[model samples]
Target: MRLLITNDDGVHAKGIHALCKELEKYHDIIIVAPDDQRSATSHSITIAKPLIVKEVELPDIKSKAYSVSGTPADCVRVATDQIIKDKVDMVVSGINIGYNLGTDILYSGTVSAAVEATLCSVPAIAVSTESSAEDYVYENAAKYIKKVIEVAVSNKLHEDIVLNVNVPPIKDEDIKGIKVCKIGKLQFHHYYKETGKEQENLVYKLEGERVVNHVEETDSYYVDNGYVTVTPLHYDLTNFNILKDVGKWF
Candidate 1:
């Protein structure tokens, strides 16, 4: 398969490098990622300003690479729409430095990059690590991702769906197994704290505390208990059940 690879953690991130190393052994891979970290930007594109793209040299891997001065979604949109000349079989987004599970994925640029691929009528898979924002265990996550890619390729996925994967940060042997599950909660309580004032205006930063997902078989619970999780996700936000109920009011 010819795979277009990307991540929210920037072009030089270890996670993306490790993923390309493992997968390039089997598939033709290309990297188009943000020049800097663009985490949590979600589905945003560079509409107002012109996006800058540059071909870059990635050490130790030979696959063609480019760096985009925009969000992760911008990388995919520009790459598919303008950059790569050949057809892409799939968009494999991330071995992201941090998890993008549950509700937090709505704010995740890694998952959103794959979502952008689906909008382009291409199949995609977004994978992430359960590691904290800065952890050095990406190769482990990358190894599992290669397997997931193999399975996904053998059995094609619908363009409307993306396989969202989250791997626990552990040695390969210690990982219990892969679990196919539903999305779960990332934060139980959410709030913001006033950090300081910027000149005359008050500045605030969003904060949240996580609560365990006691519900079994969710992505949260499985990863919390040492299992790698894969959840089928779609971009459609329509509330089908409420459609008919709200029709009577009109």
Candidate 2:
């Protein structure tokens, strides 16, 4: 299979490299990633200015890799539209350093890249880790990602769905296995702090409280309990169920 691999963690991140190493074994891989970390960038694309992309080499990567001066979604957009010659069988984003569970998906560049692929009518998967602990387990995540990709490709995933996977950062033996789950409505306690002043502009930094409550059968709950959670996502934003109720106001 031919796969386009990308991530928000930049071209040199260990996570992306780990992903390239693993997937390259059975698939022809093409990696197009940001020149620097673009975490929490969502589905943003570069438009105002010309995007700068350059081919680069990695220590142990066997795939063709490129570094782009743009967001994660930009990588996929450019790769699919211009870079690669043949039709890419699938798109895989991440092996992200931290979890993209629940509402985190709304702000995740990793997941957004995969979403961009799905929007382009390609099967995609976004993989993430639940912990930022010293023991960042890429091997374990890679194993599960391989299985997930195989299943997704075999079924030829529908255009409406993109798989969002979050793996617990535990030793392989300790993992509780995989769980097909729902996106939880988890909110982070965060605030914006003014860090600097530049002329008439104010520089603020958004910080999280690093705490959350879990709900059963949701992405957070499954990942918190050591299971790899897979949640199918789509681009539709309309709340169709409430259309009739809200229509009464008109």
In order, candidate lDDTs are 0.89, 0.88
Model 1, 102-199: lDDT tens per residue?
A: 88899899999999999998899999985554444688787888888888877778777799999888777889999999998764567989999999
In candidate 1, which residue ranges exceed 4 Å CA deviation?
Answer: 132-136, 198-200
User: Cα RMSD (Å) per model?
Assistant: 1.9, 1.8
Model 1 residue 109 lDDT? Answer: 95
The window of 10 residues in a row where model 1 has the poorest summed lDDT is 130-139
**Candidate 2 lDDT by residue in tens digits, 127-169:** 9985454434987788889999888878878866799999888
> Pick by lDDT: which candidate is best?
1
User: TM-score of the candidate numbered 2?
Assistant: 0.94
